[model samples]
Target: MMRWLSFLQLCLSLLLILPLPLEAFEPLTMGAIGLGAVGFGTYFKEYTYCKFTECCDDRSIPANIEALRSSLNRYLFGQHIVAQHIIPALSAHFQSRSTSRKPLVISFHGQPGTGKNFVADQIAKALYLKGSESSFVSKYLGQADFPQAGMVDAYKARISREVRNKLHECPRSLFIFDEVDKMPSGVFDTLTSLVDYNAFADGTDNTKAVFIFLSNTAGTHIADHLGNLMKGGKLREDTRLSDYESLLKRAAYNLDGGMKKTTMIESHVIDHYIPFLPLEKSHVLSCLQEEFWRWDRNPDSQKNKKLIDDIIDTSISYDRTHGLFAISGCKTLEKKVAVAVNYS
Candidate 1:
């Protein structure tokens, strides 16, 4: 009897040490698991929808051409020509919508510190009303989006998909590609199809979307054209789009990586190549005034006046002889003013 009991105990210990199949464990019922998954998925979907569509509730986007112009002028200083050209084109495009019309594609070319990016932002802000952060607007930086030559193709594919996805979310989405001068050559070529007429299977059209490409490709040529006009005894205001548009286009086409050789330009999908002339001292001063007002500094105060004067006098300019423009345009003007105000 004792031997039999010892044998029974050893068998029990062996059984406990052996592994069991995974299926031996109890599991949740299919119905219960499915219901929990559905609940979580539904909640996630609604949460994402609310986050993206929140900007839509504002409805503060400029409704008319005059409103757009006012917003642009107030926010972006010394872009009078850009406003004059873009506003009319925008008004016409907004008024007319048809299957035959392609999406509006505008390229802004200028030096750094010029209001190229600012103007682009104001345009999208006035139209989308939610600013650049909206779901309706997709902004890309060339360096940030495409870091390597090997990644250009992948970047192109992703960009096309993002544009389509944004359009699906909001058909009239805005795409801003900043620093096109640094973008890969083939990247923008991919946008040609979308920029033209895009008819999807779901009966959705994306031709009304806007594409803005900002580059510094034609900056020097634009400045040269203006300098030539000045040398010929012509006033800067007298210079028109006709004078520099062709030159600017040619200069861009000559560039190696920008939109010049791309199909977007070859096929003429770009509607405008608006030039942003270098800012003069007066323009910089105007920018300074705008910055000061933005800070709520007392404009009439003698201390503030002296502060503004000292800041302007000390700030570096590219053309010291003429002092026509700051080296960084209004890019550093605001910071300079802030520092002066804080110290004084």
Candidate 2:
């Protein structure tokens, strides 16, 4: 009678511990119940815990992708090219069943305040429940992490190990490297194998990971190209990816910075070179309106317009030749808006 009670207690414990629904468990024969319970408990406790977590599931991909698209369109100003190109690429990579030949590698190049970092954050928020704070998301700032050029070798090994460990733990990881232009040239070489096609490291398949590289390296080229296009009587809306992608790649490869002469560029490991174009005056206005909304202020009110006009007139600088593009982009607008809100 005591043995039967012990078996029932063990069965109840298993029902509580296992991730499966209660209905999945059935009456176990008392003959070998004790031994089976012990083995099952050990395996489920260790394996099922991780497998059932949010990290291991791709069921949220479609909903997350839709959320990402909505966020980008609603929040990100200017850079229609970025919004148009990135969505399709991301959808293809995440939704497909067959393993990708390589991880999705996107290098965002543009001037300051053109929404590179903002877009990256939105992508993270859309994909993970905790967004940028998710354990699976890793962000590295080039200047802060690899400040000294002399420590390139040590930085390489550390970053390589970190990437391997993260991918080993969760294959669907996102790595955002900001200020890549400030990182030492050789540091990216260490990441070559991790980003390449059919690559595996530390016994983990790296093809499921996503890497986003953000830099101000090609901002000038992007701005200049846009200026030239406008000068030739082309509307900014009509500008296409072809107009700036090759220029960005060449600038990234030949320019002096983290990406200069990096193997990633030379071998074409970077799948997309998305250019964040210089913000026009209208885009800056939209940004100011959004900032106003954040503060619960009426963006279209005369008082707000007066403040926004002052900001546009005094704080933001436009292209010297055409006065069409915002020189500093929307980078400085947030502070200006905050100051205006405080004073008014």
Candidate 3:
């Protein structure tokens, strides 16, 4: 009798401790999944549904417009990719890969309304045209979704495997993750693992995908902070402008003062001013935690002091209009399809 009870307990423990199998996070609600992509709730308002590129024919897009700018011309308005920051990444990705090596991993983050989506879309187009590609369909999983292993690692693994399969079928392709900041830390850590290596093994290749995280965590404040460190923040904008006008003379006079030196897009106008600084990850997460906790306290979003958990569980965000762009079901992957890249 004692042996039988011990055996039963051992089996039960093993069952409970087993690594989660993929497909458990498959999308059922919140929108399309498994080949069916869904619409992005318009940040400002509802617009016409975005038809998947599979539906688009070769004749629809111009052949000369093989690059990012032309590809995004139809969909983007004022929202555009910062070509200065992104073009080099693409060139590097394209130029590299002589043999087996780690892939490039780029993390883009900024404050809300800093045009995270626009940059992501440009990067998507760039990667998509390089050959063939796959994307993880986003779902709006809430805060409660964050703690579960079923929701995080396995779900992300499923997508990675899908991308890997596509790569074997089509060696040239890219994978992109939009609004990745919202996913739980478990998934983030797993994705980061692959990203750090920039490569995956052959067995897991079935769903391995190129990883890019588009985020709003990076902010403009870092530039100012760096600027202040170089020259006291006491100098007002107008004074700084005057100093720029006299830059050459200031350099000769020993007044270069360690102020930052930056280049402008057009020398003829010189209307644009640029600040230099990489948006550190720590600042972004700090702001994110604050927002996460703030949303946690809101009465409308809280599941309660007792019932479910995960700070992202109760977070709320509104677009240009007051309508709620709920983050309830944001993890989904569209089915993979075979297509040829004819950027011509």
Candidate 4:
């Protein structure tokens, strides 16, 4: 039996390597070859190569917008505009069976700790089974990746090559550029072509990929816009993307950052400018409650309220106007919670 199996395996290897037409083989030989190929090919492709390649599947693409929506709604705190605009845009983008004219480029503009990076991670998680850790996902930090101001030309070439290579490897790749405000000017000029409508120009169809730029460039504009709306007695939920989209674009374009004077923005390669509003005091409290629950420190209502208040007064800083909004959002809440839990 072992001898027969080895003979069959050898025959299969030869058949695969030679690529002989099926018509060249006799009917019985073809049948045996087909059986052997199916058995061994299935084993190698499914169990062996999958472990190394992180084989692509339905999860490799953005298929379930509703799942993403649910995740953003549940875990992402106090960014209604983000969910409202982003979900619909993503839904439309993924729903279209036709090839895209351009890559999906979204610029997340907001203050730090206002869920910019968090939302990017959520999008990655929804698209790939491994989420942000997926091989297809590439995250770049501006200051970290391109620190030297004199290395603009070098950075541009390197970033373009990296992006092209990644897209070549996985066309459905997700590229997140964090702290984009810190990157050197013209660094992204190399990427304008990759994110543009052109397809297969350099043997890579980039239209299926997604590029996300997270910046604090227009954070002040976003917060001020929201503040103005609030001052006029307008609810944050009532404000639309239109209210802040133009403001953010203008700020990003005018601001002295990586995005300034870039063709990607001027030519409108960026499809959406999603604004993350500053977190209000109520949002901070929600974050605190969530953190406490995460730590399994479910104190009584009074004790929990006291702890939250103490944390807010001691650690959290509020805006000067009405003391309604948190300056740092929930970025520091987890650490503060840990300390509070340890002490109390």
Candidate 5:
């Protein structure tokens, strides 16, 4: 395995290596506007690249499929998607005959970049191919608490109804609740009935369904990143750069530009795969000064390199101490994940 720098190089190399097609190819899949439809499915070309082609399932998986990857998807920069370990606990709740129990119910909460969306996307694909599916989006309601007078119940019913419809449409789907922590306590209690045994109104087999609750930095898991902010602006703490901070700020700033916007460099480092802080303006200018020289291939560029070299020379060495944050000069390892992210 290459260091983080190599990943950057790999991303660049792959882009260079891709074969440019002579003619435009039609996109493999098409979609429309519905909670039911907004996914990239059945899109990749189903080409047979092996000799024993019949053995390989010609069915093309979505390019985004990543259940097997052990790490957070690079695409989910600075987010805490549920690790594979937590998934099994939810899976355990559904080990019975489908007819014997109600579907499983689960909830998740976490900081903004803590991988909730990424985890949901992975679960959806897996369920599409294997199990039942349903989804709840907190953004559907206008308010964080969803206090729109019956709108919460309506959305809940709509999601439950959709789940019923989806069960009929596809035999299995993994129900995902995005931004679950944002829902009001009342609404969450109503939905969480399925999690508590005998809490369902019908007293049916709802417990059989797969259940999950995703929380970033919840309790001890969140103590480091979220620290006091989990108390909702009441608790004060010295620790910063948290998902809670990012989420609350987004909520407070909406379209006002008051909150610091999320950046690509912060996103990649937030994943814990790398440790990088968002670059300040001066840091960015210095970086640009260094990058300005990479463009010139002529010997006259020696001065430009020397300037960058001097800067690197005087700067604090990025060694084990730098790993305290999620970034480094080692941009050669995963050329893919690296180039995909703009750390500079």
Candidate 6:
């Protein structure tokens, strides 16, 4: 049996070494080749599935890194922190793929209308190569999925199953949990285990997955912290991750939310605690300009300038000194812009 297996391997190796088109191998032939090489044919099936059925899956490296970088830079407005920290972190992660290969766990903490969800969507689009609708990218809303008290266990089971299923299908899956501040605290602990570098019995490898948690619980705290920095003569742009990373983690772990008392933070598993600072007037102005360009409206027109001013005027503010503390951020800017554009 050993001699027969050795002969089969030699023949298969020679066959695979031949300069032949991939399409020339039929399904049965591919299965045979895989069996001879790997002792089973399932690996070949996964390759074919990725090659033909799931062309947009995140399992492969993006074809155009420069294009992705440009799009991310363009779309995620007012997020220079992302370009600074998140982009470099991702670059390192991708570059040293074989050495670490751990799950990229990121937590986005910020106020509403700050671009946490927007940036998350953009990242998924860039990595999956299929926009936001890719099968490998799974998103769960805390309010929608785990709203009630008694549903915590059920939610845990379902998310675990879904995550495992997706990872089994494609190891490079992306999971985003939006509004996680509303989720039950126990859920975080459940996910903590899965995010670790462990291979399941059913062939689900968690190391290649990415987990993102978005929360509003730490928003006010983050805003206050940044505001204090400004008051102390520290420029907002000069605020680094070290300034607010521990604060965000404290808020998430101590506050009444998904991560409260969870070991995920204590164990130091979360790769980054990204703070999405509250958008100021200039940032809001940038957002308005983006909206104008998105709708093909000329931003420099006199009418548009008045419209932008009106939008900024109407957005309620907390800080009377700078009038930059937009309570709603850019959330209401669209409707404000619409009213301005239509009425003008």
RMSD to the native, candidate 5? 18.9
Tens-digit lDDT track for model 2 on 1-344?
Answer: 67457656777976775667655555564435556867766645544554455544553222288899998889898878999999998888887526687788999999899999999999998888778887889999988998999998998898889998998887888999999988888888889888887545337878788899999998888888899998899988899999998899899998877898989988889999999999988999999999999999998999999999999888888877667788889898888899999998
Model 6 per-residue lDDT tens digits across residues 57-154: 43543723456578767766666676677777666666665576578899999888888877787777677767568788899998888888677788
Candidate 1's residue-wise lDDT over 1-344, tens digit each?
A: 67447555655754763366645544664455456558655544454454555433224334356767887767777666787799988887777744446788888888788899888877776786567766778889988887676787888889888887877766677889988888777777787888875567865567777889899888766766676677689877777777878877887777855575788878888889899887777777778778888898875678877877776778756654344546578888777887877776
What's the ranking of the predictions by TM-score, best on top?
4, 2, 6, 1, 3, 5
Off by over 4 Å in 5: 1-66, 69-81, 90-102, 130-150, 153-171, 195-208, 211-221, 225-344
| Residue pairs in collision within model 6 | none
Clashes of each: 0, 0, 30, 0, 56, 0
Report the C-alpha lDDT of model 3 over 94-130, residue by residue, as the tens digit: 5554442555544443344344455465555454432
Candidate 1: stretches off by over 4 Å? 1-64, 98-100, 198-204, 320-323
RMSD of each: 14.0, 6.3, 23.8, 4.9, 18.9, 7.3
Output the lDDT of residue 226, model 1: 71
TM-score of 4: 0.86
Lowest-lDDT window of 10 residues in candidate 4? 55-64
Per-residue lDDT over 202-305 for candidate 5, one digit per residue giving the tens place of the 0 to 100 score: 43344434444343323223333433343355332233334444443343223211011323112221111111222222333243342353333221356544
TM-score: which is higher, 1 or 4? 4
Which 10 successive residues of model 3 have the least lDDT summed?
332-341
Local error of candidate 6 at 179, Å?
0.2
- How well does candidate 3 score on lDDT at residue 225? 38
> Where does candidate 1 have its weakest 10-residue lDDT segment?
54-63
Global lDDT of model 3: 0.36
Q: Top lDDT: which candidate number?
A: 2
